[model samples]
Target: MHRAERPVLEVADIFRVHGPAWRQTVQLSLGQLKVMSAIEQCRSAALGGHVLRCSGCSRTEIAYNSCRNRHCPKCQASAAHRWLEARQADLLPGEYYHVVFTLPAVISAIAWYNKAVLYGLLFDIAADTLRTIAADPRHLGAQIGATLVLHTWGSALTHHPHVHGIVSGGGLTSDGERWVACRPGFFLPVRVLSRPFRRRFLEELAALHRRGQLRFFGEYAALADPAVFARWLAPLRVCEWVVYAKRPFAGPEAVLAYLSRYTHRVAISNQRLVALDERGVTFRWKDYRAKGRTRYKTMTLGADEFMRRFLLHVLPSGFHRIRHYGLLANPVRRHNLAKIRGLLHATATGAQAAAANAPPGNLPPRFICRHCGAPMVIIDILQRSAPIRAPPAQRAAA
Candidate 1:
């Protein structure tokens, strides 16, 4: 039986080849080390797998298991599919808006050192900003639901912290009596959202500092002083915080398509990597500042530098990257959805509602024959193999 070809290159390959040497030059946290190890072993014999035989041609092969680490670039596709299936029921027939709130570079630098506190604040404050603006009489003037996702890397893997929010275009009235819709193709104004978002975030950030919840290091070590911290924040108060809303989605289907791409993304995907060699790791990146064709381009970075940039986004241990707020909050989501559906005259339940909103596509089965295009069935299970040990030199450095 013929086995399928693996990608010419993957993050896993880079990690296995260069990670040991890189670990020697820098201090990595336990969590970071674990992530590197996971990527290196994913979908290899080290994890063990199962024997599968094709029903059509009697061809057999071994299928290894994935590491399933949330941070692994190799594993997010299936994760995203499963997540989208659950979210099908949450879709509303009304228009949906995509909103992004970004912290300036100055704040992002400190955020690198205080991810849990600062990132958590980013999610909470961004959600609060949307609800506050939507509830204002001048805006949509209702209680809207939103799903917010935090992304810490830019196209080039820089430490750019931002939250992408998917908000229902309208909301239920303050008394929960009826549905209210915003003007066609329009959501809340970005200028209005920016001011309050900026104010509340800085206010909350100062509070965290006052309580000694934030950390500073190296060049920023002076920020530990309360007076020094205030001075550092002075410029941020006057700066225009980046908050913008894209046009309303084409329909519920479009929103699902968007969610599928964004919800489970890593710092980089295997598909984007073009090559790896003595020159460096080459990959595609978009330059948002440029217009048209000029926006798309490739970048090359030394393998060591690439790995460092990728690990910068590992996240604090157990931090939740995706969150729901306002009407979409988990505890009340089902009840709130049922009520909204009633108002919209589409009060279907369970399988019926999910069917109506589900995106059109058939997810492939877990195993398929590489030779004859037939489904494969497992014939035997293989237990995990013994763990591999690092070289003595590498062990000492790590």
Candidate 2:
């Protein structure tokens, strides 16, 4: 389902009314307001952009430029292409894995208030846990690279903060000699990873508390006290933290396909939106837990309630949603990727190398104007504005 369209349809009324009141409200943060404005004006003429016309038939087509913000649904296709291009050269000749590290509702509550700190903590703990475990002699005994993305919402647009990790199946040995691979069907012990992640996260939280770095208010006020913080963490120690690992992908191609679909996905899509009537907003969502989960279900929610749920996922300013760790670390990524490729090339060749190094395939051609059959150019861009006016006609000789 194209969940990206839901917001544009559902929030039409809210944009019509409270859109001007943005300057007055403090609870509605700048990020939220910016998203609201984008939702209202996206695909409309309020922001100048472009329009297309067919030369042969003289049929004018209206098209708008996307904000291209990572959070914007319409912009993700191009974003995914660019990201895949950058990573093409870095692909290793081996299996890849999809791992997810989820924060419990308890921590999610605190994260709602202190997003920057807590979200950073979540990434650090998850990455550090994987790195530490992989380096252990009992495990893979190699340093790995992981691409981590932070997602704060679930399929139904609920607040469920989690980090999704796309990890290269193997890694270079500590001395950068050989590419070490993992056993089939297993990556790391989930129990071990969960325990360490929980411990490391709590340790950092404790440090933040001692340094007076964490702000506690609303339901999280009790965490301000040291004793209360300890008690809050105690329950978490015994409960099993979920660290899900899907079966390894065939190679980097499969991994990139998964990333293209999952990465940059917003809470909802435009196509899934059915209507925005007095019954509130209606949209479709997937039930991931159910078998044959391909079926989509419709949900109706009040406008105010829908807005609240949507705003819950707006991140703090300048916060990065995607991050890299270990060999994929920014400073040494190019050098490390080159070395890794050299090693992989020594072992593998032909189709594998071509797949790893080649650029993504071309996009299909667009429809041409019927009259002149000339490729039309976008003349003006419009977002949520009045219907486009017809282009002026040229009179033929009688």
Q: For each candidate, give its TM-score against the true structure.
A: 0.92, 0.83
How many clashes would you count in candidate 1?
Answer: 0
* Per-residue lDDT over 140-208 for candidate 1, one digit per residue giving the tens place of the 0 to 100 score: 889999999999999999999999999998999999999999899999999999999999999999999
What is the Cα-based TM-score of model 1? 0.92
Runs in model 2 lying further than 4 Å from the true structure: 1-26, 51-60, 288-296, 346-375, 378-398
Worst 10 residues of 1 by lDDT: 386-395
Winning candidate number (lDDT):
1
The per-residue C-alpha lDDT of model 1 at residue 275 equals 96
lDDT of each residue in 183-264, candidate 2, tens digit only: 8767888888888988888788888889999888976888899899888888887887888888998777788788887777
Give the clashing pairs for model 1: none
- Shift in Å, residue 71, candidate 2: 2.5
- What does each candidate score in C-alpha RMSD? 3.7, 8.9
